[model samples]
Target chain A: MLEVSNLSVNYRGIRALDNISLTLSPRELVGLIGPNGAGKSTLIKAILGLVSFQGKVQFRGKPLRRQRQRVAYVPQRSQIDWDYPVTAWNVVMMALTPSIGWLREPDHRVKQAVSAALDRVDMLPLRHRQIGQLSGGQQQRVFLARALAQQADLFLMDEPFTGIDQKTEAIMLEVFADLKRKGKTLLVCSHEWGQALSRYDRLLLINRQLLANDRPQVVMTMENLHRAYGQSLQTTMGGNAMGFSFC
Target chain B: MLSPLLSPLAYEFIRNALIAGILVGILCPVVGTYLIVQRMTLLGNVIAHAVLPGLAIAHFLTIDILWGAFVSGLLSSFATNWIRAQTRIKVDAAMALTLASFFALGVILITRLESRLDLDAFLFGDILSVTVKDVWQTALITGVILLLVKLFYKELLFYTFDPLGAQAMGLPIQVINVGLMAAITLTIILGMKTVGVILVTSLIVGPAITAYLLVKELHQMMALGGLIGALSSVIGLYLSYFLDLPSGPAIALTVFGFFLLGLLLRPVCNLNRENSVGKKLGKKYRSQKSEVSQELEPDA
Candidate 1:
């Protein structure tokens, strides 16, 4: 379980995330949705302590930062350098880095875990290929393998579906379900809507602040969407009623 | 056939230079690979130039130039970070500004404080002038860098490839980052003896980039780049000996030549292979494309 209270992030005197609070229980998959610059990524970064922020984040009643090893994060694909000359196997092995003894190579068990994780994502056959040589979906899968290999209790993913093939999306959803079945917690940040929106058990609609945190159907209401998207929805309805209706 | 090579080995200066060059050959590319992967090759050049001020100050003060070089190199990097943090200037501009200011200060100090410091030796090194102590220093730095790299390869790999993920995993990324910068700086200082400040970046970047074009993995790139670097040093030394050219320039040019050759020849060589890696990659891609299309169908 994870809890945050009074979380605020400022960038050069501008409030990026303003006094947000939320909690996530185990065996739940929560989707974080917002318009561009809505602080979804910033909120995650604040929670992970990747960015400086004023907040209290706790995991299972302990300071989250102190219990970080129980957490696994998959950053936005755009945040990584695809040209980096590493194999899928190597990327997955990163999950076991904290456990490996200092100055020693990965042992048999480490290799086995990496192999099994890679196999779980159906990427074991391409394990030796350079990461850059893989497709976008394969690259995402490689990182999924990395998260699976972490064997963490909490998973925080930033835009795991962006620019990925449908296969990767299906696989990601399947993995999320599997993790939830195992009593793991997942917080997935996504800009997607429509059929994909129905998959999450709950949604946190936010724009610089928490607008709604409830079931997907409850949070996807027009009022919450208007609050998050702002005047754009009004403009759409005034200019193109059909378009607004489709939305 | 081997007499010319053996004859050079007889001279103490040549032996020392060769030892220094061989060590640089091994070290530069290893560090250079990190630079290339991080897209910080320009930072290496900046640190190289930035060391100039420190070198001049050390000469004026009659202190060890390596200490001065290390301090100035660290300062330049720190200054870049400071400027980026405090101003709207981007990293490239920050590095440019720091590089120019440091080099100008170094030049001013050298000209005004001491005219007989042999600035050329600092700018463009004289490999034949390397002493036994220089060899020992190079060895020590090399040992430390390689040992540290071996011990922290996983953390380094994770951080460089995915910094946010690494930080999220609770790795001390700030410490790792500072450590990486220090290692790169130490590498630049050690390389200063053979290639000097001016051409040392070539010694670092050329072989690594060349290896990058040929290899698909980081360790392979480092290994191949190391081999190319050492080979270039030996070949450059020989070219210098036989052609009566400046040894540092010769070595730098030779490494550049290697990079150019790899760039031009990789595709041509790939064209003739039985199971060309590129073709194999294409085959795998075609299969992935079909899988993607099949899954994309609405009914699926």
Candidate 2:
């Protein structure tokens, strides 16, 4: 569903990501795992055309720009301004704006789509809550809801499991599985590889470049893990309202 | 036993000042919120100061001030864009350069106009000198801006909150940005006669910031922003009347006063048990920030 070639991103003199090549087929569930500063997000941003990069990215056999409508991106919950005065519903509504009018009110169809999307994520309960009031997992769910509203064929999520409750994570996995069943492809970036291995069908270990890409059992060997995240796994606890535990 | 004691003549000026301040107040904060969020205060300052030369030239020609302000504001707007496009110079630096050069040019023009023009009227603002023509101009610009804001509300919201998302949506993000900037440029020029260049930003920042504290929704915040703007305007005009001070400063300080109220009231509101949503949001924000850097640099 997506192809990236020679992708390199340099922030000033520091190279965040070196030349990297990877591809995903239709209906594929791909997992990206790496250490901090491993260019996991840099790859995502480069593919989304949000960053300046030397490489090229193609989606659905079309150029990235042309296929943007078919792709839905769920950035890390931390990247969003939760304080933005928008309801869960408003955020969902926003994802559909590309399909509808900017200023025009949503038609019944759009509303129905948002409703179904929210329902898929089990977030229809908190549809009216101020987004800022949501927990990290809930915030991620909202983005999932938004993507669902996008009704896109391809899903790109960054750190979807970070800070989320185990229940929420399972629910998200189910949603992704359901999406895959519907012939929708997903590429999820995650720090927790143990959990991702079970959730994703294929795994790609990345650290500045593609270290490995294959079945989880073959690609997630200790050698590849050391090459990607190193032997001493780094743990950073985010102080979020959810009080997520790392150890 | 109180009496409603306002003479028609005094009342007219009071109404005019109040209404004028109210309009500027809403527009400033509504626009200022985006500016502050995006760290574009310097841009507003630049545009505000940059238009002085235009106003000065207008004075020289002895035509309407808004006309001169508009021309100069547009020139400075283009200048800002040109500098942004050409150099590695960041936005603040470009604003500093263009605003400084243009404002310096304005200073020279003001110096020239001093020989043939009214000083206090432009610098401190002569509220009493406000004619029906000035009112008409203010009203016209207010209508233009509010209309523009209404038309572009969705796109502006998208751009302000998420520039990347807006770009992905195939929206003419650049054109929208330029359009918003143009509206701000017009707002500053129109407000110059009432608030003067030095103090116009407060009107913009105060109402919105104040409302930001009071509400959690965008629509509510904007409405409250306008309400605060209007409230401050009336209060400022009334204070100006009794104190016999300049209208713009009075109105500007009034907006500041409202900001103080917001500061004092925020904690009180947050402390309210019934406002659990506010308290919850406050706690959540604290928690999220705490998790920002888990894999820290050991040396650092």
Best by DockQ: 1
RMSD over all Cα atoms, model 1: 3.6
Q: For candidate 1, give the lDDT of residue A41.
A: 94
Best-fitting candidate, measured by lDDT?
1
In the order shown, the chain A TM-scores of the predictions are 0.94, 0.90
Interface RMSD of 2: 7.6
Superposition TM-score, candidate 1 onto the true structure:
0.92
- Give candidate 2 misplaced runs (Cα > 4 Å): A10-16, A222-247, B1-5, B8-16, B56-102, B108-123, B263-300
- In candidate 1, stretches whose alpha carbon ends up further than 4 angstroms from where it belongs are A234-247, B268-300
Interface RMSD of each: 5.1, 7.6
TM-score of each: 0.92, 0.82
- The collision pairs in model 2 are A1-A24, A238-B291, A239-B287, A239-B291, B28-B204, B29-B204
Give DockQ for candidates 1 onward, in order.
Answer: 0.50, 0.20
lDDT of each: 0.86, 0.75
lDDT tens digits, residue span B1-300, model 1? 988679988899999999999999999999888888988788898899898888888878889988998999988988987898777788899989889999998899888887467778878988899999989999899988988887888888888888888888888988998898899999998887788889999989999999888777788888999999999999999999989999999999999899889989788643553245435545666767665343223231
> In candidate 1, residue A162 scores what lDDT?
82
